[model samples]
Target: MKGAALDTPHIAFVGAGNMASSIIGGLIASGHSATCITAADPFPASLERLRKSAPVAVYNDNAEAARSADIVILAVKPQIMAEATDSIAAVVRSNNAVVISIAAGVTIASMQARLGPEAAIVRCMPNTPALLQHGASGLFGNDNCSAQQRDFAQRVLSAVGITCWVDSEQELDAITALSGSGPAYFFLFIEAMIDAGQALGLNADIATKLALQTSLGASQMALQSDVDLAELRRRVTSPGGTTECAVQSFEQSGLRKIVATAMHAAADRAAEMAREMG
Candidate 1:
C-alpha cells in the first residue's frame, strides 16, 4: 500500500509447503523480520522444517495462524482449498484480513463465497521457480480488495521475483499456463539438450552442466539485453554456419510450432480446470 511500504507486516502462510517456504525464505532474505511471519501446516514434517529456519511460530491449524496476521496466504492445493478455507474461515472473516490464494483453478468469487463477503481476496498463480527466488507471479484482486491490499500483496510477491497484474480473473488461466507451468517446459527442453549433448560424446555431468548454464545465460541475456530475440538469433546464426544449421533443423522439425501448440494446450487445460472447479 502507498507505493510499496517498507514496513515489515505480519504475514501468515496457510500451507508451509515448498512455495510457502520459498516465499518465507525470500521475505526473510529481503530483510523482513522473521518474527513477523508465521506458517501453518497439517504435516509435522513441514512444520518442523519451517521452524528450523524461521523464527516465526508454526501451527498445525490454519485458523491459529490467521488469528493475528494482517495478511494470510492460502497455498494449499486447488483440490483441498475449500476444506483449507473452511478450516480458517471463521478467523479470517472475524479479522477481515486480506487473503492471497495461490491455488490454481480456485476463482476469486469462490474464495469470497467461502471466506465471507468482507474478505479482501487476491488470487495469484506463481510457478515452482519461486523456490529459487526467480518466479514470475500473476495476480488479480477482487472488488473487496482495496488499492492498499493489492499493493501489499504485490510487495510480498515481488520480494521473490517479478510480479504482473491482470485486469480480468479469466486471464489467470492463461497466466497459469504461461508462468505457472512454463518452468517445467524449459526444464524439459534442458533435459533434451543434455541428452543430445551426451549422444554427441560429452559426459553426462558435463552435458548437464553445459545445458543448464546455457539456459541460464540465454535467459539472463534476454532479460538484460535490449536486442530482440530474433536479432539475437540472427547475430549468432551466420549463413550456413553451425548455429544456422541447427536453427534450420529446428525449423524443419517444427519446434516453434510445437512449442506454441503445447502452450495453447496447457492454457486450454487450465481453462477447463477453472470451469470444472467453478
Candidate 2:
C-alpha cells in the first residue's frame, strides 16, 4: 500500500466507470490515499475522469493492475467479466488476492470457472445510488473466501454505503430484485408523482422538487425511525382523510400486486441472466 496505512490493502478496480469512480471517490474521501488505488479501463476517457477526481494509478491492462493489488474489484459489466477475469486470473491467483465483483448477474460459480476454483470470490449487487453514497449493497461469498477477505470486501463496499451479507448465492437473485433494481422502482414512482403534480397545475420544476424532497424525507424517516414502515404510513393516513383517500385509490388500483409482480419479474430476469452468463 503506497499511500494507505501499513495494514490497508492496495485496491485495484478492473473498470473505471461510474460505479468504480464512486467507490474510489468514497475511499479517497475517507482517507485512503489515491496512490493506494489503481484503476484499469480500456477507455482513455474513463481513466481521464477518474484521474480528475483522484490521482490513482491508471492502467489500460487489467492484468498489470491486478498483478500488484491485494484486492481486485471487478467492476466491469457481467457480459465482459469472463474476458476481464481471464486477463487477470493468473496474477490474482498467484498473489492470493481477494476478488470482489459488483457486476450484476455474474455468479460466483461463473467467475470460479474463469478465475479457478481456489480463487476467493465475493459477488455484490449495488445500485446506481452508490454514486451518491446512499447505496445498499448485497454481498455473497464463495466457500473459498476467508473471513478476512469477506471483511475486506465489506469495508471496500461500505465506502459508498451500507452492506449486508447473504448466506446463499440464490438469495443474491432476490437481493438483485430488491436493492439492485430498487432505485429504478423509486424513480418510476417519483416520475409518476411529478407528472400527477404537474397535471394538477404545478410547474415542472416545483413538481419535481416536491416529489424528490418527499421521497428523500420519507426514506430518511424510515431509516431513522424504529417504527415499521406500514405503521409510519398509517400514522400519516387518518380515517377518511386525504391521505387515506389517496391510499385507498392506490390499493383500489392494485398497486401492491403490480409491485409484487414487477419485483418477481426482476428476480426471474436476474436468475435468467445468471444461467445465460454462467
Candidate 3:
C-alpha cells in the first residue's frame, strides 16, 4: 500500500504472463497505485513484459514478492499450479493473505492441499475478454475465506469486468461452460455471420464490419433493456418476415438442442479437467 490508498492492501502476482499483465494494467488504470502492486516470474522476459505493463516492483523469486503482500494472485497454468502454489505456500500462510487463483481447473481443494486446510483461497474462471475490461468471472471461495476477503476478491476481479459468486464450488463447472468458454461461442457465431454475409454477395471487409457491429449493438441492447431475451427475440421475428424465416430454419435444425449439447459437453470437460489436475 506504499503508493496506493492507506486502506489498499499490497497485491502480488505469482506470474507475469498476458492475463496477469492485463489485470495489473487494468487495476492501475482504474485506481490502484502501481506502488501497491508487485510481480514475480522466473523468466526475465515475463518480468520485463510485466514491468512494461505497470510500474510495479519485480522479483525473480516468488516468495520475495509475495512476502509482504496482502493478496497473492495465482496466474500460472493449471498444470503448473501445484508447483507455483508450493513456491509461495509458506508466505501465503505466514501472511494470512487471501490467495486468488485465475487458473481454470485448479480447484480450491487442490490449493488447500498445498497451502493447508485453513488457508483462504478463491478459485476463479475468467474468459479472455478480461483483457478488454469486459470479462465475466466466476468465483468460488473455500469455507476458510472471510467476508472481507470475498469482497476483496470481487473488487480485484471487477477491475477487469463483472464477477459472480457461486453458492457451491461444484457450480463453477457450469459457470465455466457458460462464461469461461462463452467468448469462443460468440466468436464462432460472429465468424459464421461474416461468412454468411460474404456468401450473400457482400465484400469481406463490409461483411466483417457489419457482423461485428450487429453483435455489439445486439449485446448492448440485451444488457441495457429491461425486457427478457425471449421477448426481445419475438420483437424481431415478425410474422412471415425474413427474421421469422431465419428463426424457423434455426428451430427446424434444432439449434437449441445443439447449443445444449455443446454446453453440457463443455461443463463435463471442465469437471473432468479438475479431476485430472488433482
**lDDT of the structure predicted as candidate 2:** 0.90
lDDT at residue 247 of model 1 (Cα atoms):
90
Candidate 3, residues 34-74, lDDT tens digits: the string is: 98899998899999888776889999999999988888999
lDDT of each: 0.87, 0.90, 0.90
lDDT score for residue 13 of model 3: 95
lDDT of 1: 0.87
Candidate 1 local lDDT, residue 101: 92
In model 2, the runs with Cα more than 4 Å from the true position are 1-6
Task: Report the Cα lDDT for residue 58, model 3.
Answer: 95
lDDT for 278 in candidate 2 is 84
Ranking by TM-score: 3, 2, 1
Residue-level lDDT of model 2, residues 50-141, one tens digit each, is 99988899999998877678789999988899899999999888878889999988888888988998999999998889999888999999
